[model samples]
Target chain A: MTATQLSPGRVRKTPAGAAAPGRRRAFDRYLNPVLGAVGVAVVLASWQICASTGVVDPKFSSSPSGAFGALVDSFKSGDVWSPLGSTLSIVAWGMVISIVAAIPLGLLIGRNRVLYALTDPLISIMYSVPYVVFLPMLIFWFGIGADARVVIVVWSALFPLLINVIAGARNLEQSHLQVSRVFCASRLMTLRSVAFPATLPYILAGVRQAVGRALIGAIVAELFMGSAGLGYVVQLKTSNFQTDDAMAAIAVIAVIAVLLNHGVAYLEQRLTFWSRTD
Target chain B: MNDPRRKLVVDDLRIGHWSRRSGTFALACDGLTFDVAENAFVAIVGPSGCGKTTFLTALAGLIPVESGRLELNGEQISGPSRDRSLVFQQASLFPWRNVVANIEFGLKAQGRLDAEGRARVAELVELVGLSGKEDKYPRELSGGMSQRVNLARALATDPDLLLLDEPFSALDAQTRELMQEELTRVWQADSAGSGKTAVFVTHDVPEAVFLADRVIVLSSGPAHLVEVVEVNLPRPRGPEVKRSPEFQEISDYILSLVMSQNKPGRRTEDHDSNAALSR
Candidate 1:
């Protein structure tokens, strides 16, 4: 209302000593990208030199330029979509199932001492052990179908999310719960409004972990049992000695992984912005 | 919601908690008997770790009465009810919510965030001197600002009784003093200017004297009734009221009572006894 006082949430709009950080801010903003680009360029230049100079067989070790050309070729020929779509769909479905099932189940288990006791050892084992060891059994049960692929993805993704949600729920602040109790909130209201929001930072953290695991699960499934997907494409092309195409598919996987990670990180920042100390 | 005869009764009250670690009962308040009349501002004071906080908490229906009659309007409090709200010692605000949303939490929780409820919330935001700061998140607020939000959230519900547990204890000296005055103003201004029943629990002798119609003193841990010192200070009081001789006399008396309860060698002197001697 007053000219002197800016609106709420805008209190931090102008930091004191603003004149000082100008150069530092500019340096911080551009330094990372510029350095990253140079690092990448050097690696590509070295790889190209090795391949063209016959230091390594191009058939076995594809050059960065060759991979890029093969990538462009695959996209233009419309041969990239089917595998890409398959892998993405499996990851999406797995994430959906993990999120839906884990949050409620985690909260329920976390809140109840008896249930938490019953499941703690089981969950710890599942989360700590490599999911790859279970792949053979899952394929035996579900038979390399899309169902098996989705199940594998969920298997890899679900435990991390569940663990995080449970930890978050268990760590609910006593004071916050007291506020809810004093207000006479209904059980459902307490769960939805209090417990859920209090646990949001943890939930987002879990989601970040789950997304990475989900991608790994999808790729591993495709590599071993998938007749479709970029992972399968990479495997098949490598066997055929078309290393350039194989490297191109691997490059696509790397891009997907990076994009997915960045997307989750962005979401975490937006959703749990309040939790950040800085 | 108004009943002229509405009152809180605590007759020979006992409160305790069962600690599973030791598998034994830890008594908090033992046979503490006192009653707060309709719309009276009552303060309970004692040494640190005394059961003042526990007693106030029991009155809010957060902890069950182990025995004796602890009733509001002649009904026993079995659990936390909508009739009372507590201003916690720490400003336990939800960080995700802005000041306005945090103030609106109680109303929203009780499914009472209708038009009138929103209006009251807006009024409380102003009452607590947090008008322009309404959109600031908890992380964005200072210690004093967040406590204002905490007070507003409690007041927004318009409960029959309000319980405060040393709400200003965490603030710095100057801010605490300023807030104490703000509290007196807000307490009288809100609830249609009638000032609803308030039970404030604090270890601050001066604070207890400055605010309450009656200051109930409790002895250290497993607290029992020590003395019920009624403050006969005039209405519409301010910080200047604390400078009055009557305020000094009363606060000194209460302070001596509290200091006496502690082990004889524990404190050198926590009060201005020179003023007491001069008086």
Candidate 2:
């Protein structure tokens, strides 16, 4: 064979195939961030124009500048950080609890047909019943504290994570499992080497969706019962007719959701780099 | 051509399975017996759905032998072990693993190799002519290259008996021919002093004739060995041997047996005679 035939890299570098390494690198460095910034600017400009021109009442549809002004005032008032911190802490703890509890349950249910069948009805019922309706009962039990908010967040996050993980684990190819058997891999080794890695992308996607749901759950719980958090602040402002402050809190929640989704996506990309190339 | 010095023996092997969807026992093989001698390359050929896969699986102990005995080196085969290695038709390399990692799978399972396993993996990769593609994933490989990796992975364990189930069936004709040559080179290298035994399954007549010390033709399902034709052609055999009259005669004889079995009630046709000679 010639040197060109022996070298796999040269074959990949050929035109009309995948992009050259140098070109891909350049695109990564120069184009992605610029395009992202332009996208954000355009959305903000449209929002600002609509609000400032009174396409809707400024009282209801707060401009980008109006929301920023409210954010600055809230910061000056010295109470902003505590509520934001509280909200973040609840979200973080709730996510940890959800992951710890849901993944094992999902794997168990995924692998065993009997367990899955037994739990199917209960999970469907839990998923169908909006936890918002159970807020009063939760307050009666946990008494409107951070614990209660966390409980609500867990309720919201658990089912999607459970369902996706179960599906992922169950969907593992029989051929891969046969390979494991042929090699006589120990049960633990098979789970670690084959089961876990294969199901990681699906689990990561579930976590992404769960993070958004958890935020909504936490905020909703706080809105109904608590005197602190971004949701509480929104409730307080809206009740007092401070529409700009309420909209600002809502905007912050949107930004938080976007950031969490993107963060999970980045983690998924890193964990499943092999999958992407394939 | 029954060999007196047999390295592996399967006696009265019967393999059948009850189809879960159809709820009927589908008989794949019935009353099959064969013997492969030490350092021998034995090829089994049959048409599609002729229980070729089932027979190979039975020998590898992947499927349970319903009522038969499979002896390897005079020991009754029980289950999959390090002593016997199989190369499947599809490469079936773990997509998550790279080439080197895949080759080390059996060793890792046996817990015989340590961190120094990379050295042995490098040797096999070189043997398969995949030296620099060690870090490449299976999906990155072409069909031929992936099959090469599969062959390397099976050989890495250094098994006494190698069982290949139509291992090169997926490659194109040209690539398949090249791979057959590569396989012969590898087999000869292994057989030099070690006396490695191989059982290769294929449907291609020329492939069986080129690669085997003996070619065993199986009848259609319920399949059993119809003939075991000894190929006394000399090696290192080249592409030119395929054109020799001796090669043609043996090829024609095996093809006649296979064709005759396919149409048991009818007189053998001129098409069968011409087709067998043409290849």
Candidate 3:
């Protein structure tokens, strides 16, 4: 009764027992970016000094300035788009296919005893073995093309995601399950309402892992096969001894990796916001 | 059992299951029979491994009735139905959902969260004293608060029969007492005029006496009906009612009944209680 009462023109908005986050959030927001910039600046400064002082051959290891210059030049020349687009497209397609295929399959395998038993060994083996070992067979089957690259990405990304979803579906709380049943929710309703929301934290985690692996798979595929991607760009530049261009492409790939991770992390924050704080 | 006005009838009910893991037959309830009048608040109490929770689950249709009649409104209870709802022991709110969304789950599950249903949910939220906290998540709420949401969620559907499974047992002593008072208030507020029939299963004798018009006591494991004590306590009761002589007398009688069923003196009730809770 005391907790419920509010004076006129007043409100109680903060969650019980949680401190106000406004001041702390602002400090963290600025502090992290400042700290990250300092770390990156230190590394770049060290690299700049070594290159300028001729401590190592710039021919073999490009300086931060050289890479930065090449990056601008490549963007101006417009050749960066082709490889970046190709690699990104492959990752995008692979993720779409994997998500479409994995969620339902994992749920079915998890919910059904016979299916889980039948697939457990096969899935474990598939997840355990590196997809790098499958490159030769994949090329043999699908050839060194965009389709092959997408297939490899799916191969690498699907299992971690599938496994997480299976766990989420299988580890349902007995009380939650009972609540759903007592409400007489149909099977579909149970899945959509109870199971899906409950599984969200695990699913988001799986997506974070899957997206990281998918990017890695796409790059590796392009590197091994003489393909049209940032990986191939890095390969071609290195073979030509254009170390600056290769470093620039590497820099672009690094930015892409960081951006992809942040994108998924932001999604996790939005979707599974209730997970860790509790 | 054959009363026309009886809202619920559990006649010679036997609930048993074949456990594949143990390769044995586990009998929970044995030839139990009882009747609940329409809109009456009935509570069940027993010793630690007694089948009271199993009986409540059977009434909720989460567990199957092995034999005899377990009927609501004269229809045989088979599986879960929309006419009934259960307030689980744990709060069991989806951590992802805010309090309002969790309360709306029952209506939403049954495809009845229309404008009217939404209004009813809002009403229950207020009734349960969660007015300003509708958007709060389960983790943010205290034990007592979460159970309020649980109770509100069950009531949101306007179930004909509400089954509660030791909803306040997990709370601390003070919070549990406060919640008991809150529950009675919410029950009356939501029911408004003619109340809904409710069956509360608990190990706490005081809680059984405080909440129910009738308290049905069961024996130990393989539990059956032992006695049904009618509590003629005045309605609109408060926490102070627990200190009254009449309340203490009823609670003490039920407590002794429960204690007599225990095999050993203070035999690890906390540890083995989980079995009875989930039965």
Is 2 or 3 the stronger prediction by lDDT?
A: 3
Best by TM-score: 1
Candidate 2 residue-wise lDDT, A12-124, digit = tens: 12234355588776675668689999999999899899888888787877778988899888788976788888888899999999999988788778778999899988987
lDDT digits (tens) for residues B1-279 of candidate 3: 446468898898998766555667777789898899988999999887676777777788877888999999889999889998999988888887899999999999899999999999888888888999999988789989999999999998888899998999999999998888888887787744446789999988999999999999988867788898999999989888988999999988888888888876433243333443344
RMSD of each: 6.6, 7.1, 5.9
Best by DockQ: 3
TM-score of each: 0.93, 0.86, 0.91
Please, what are the lDDT tens digits per residue for candidate 3 over residues A71-164? 9999999989999899889999999999899888888787888999999999989999998999999999999988899999999999988988
Q: Cα deviation of A206 in candidate 2 (Å)?
A: 1.5
Candidates, ranked, TM-score? 1, 3, 2
What's the ranking of the predictions by lDDT, best on top?
1, 3, 2
DockQ winner, 1 or 2: 1
- For each candidate in turn, the interface RMSD (Å) is 6.3, 5.7, 1.2
Residues A1-278, candidate 1, lDDT per residue (tens digit)?
A: 00110111111233445586688767766897999999999999999999999999898999998999999999999999999999999999999999999999998998889999999999999999999999999999999988899999999999999999888888887778888888989889999998888777778778888999999999999999999998899989999999999999999999999999889878776776676655
Chain B of candidate 1 achieves a TM-score of 0.91
Report residue A162 deviation for candidate 2 (angstroms): 1.5
Q: State each model's CA lDDT, in order.
A: 0.85, 0.78, 0.84
Model 2 lDDT, residue A181, Cα: 64
Q: Which tens-of-lDDT digit does each residue in B166-220 have in candidate 1?
A: 9999999999998888988998999654688899988888988999999998887
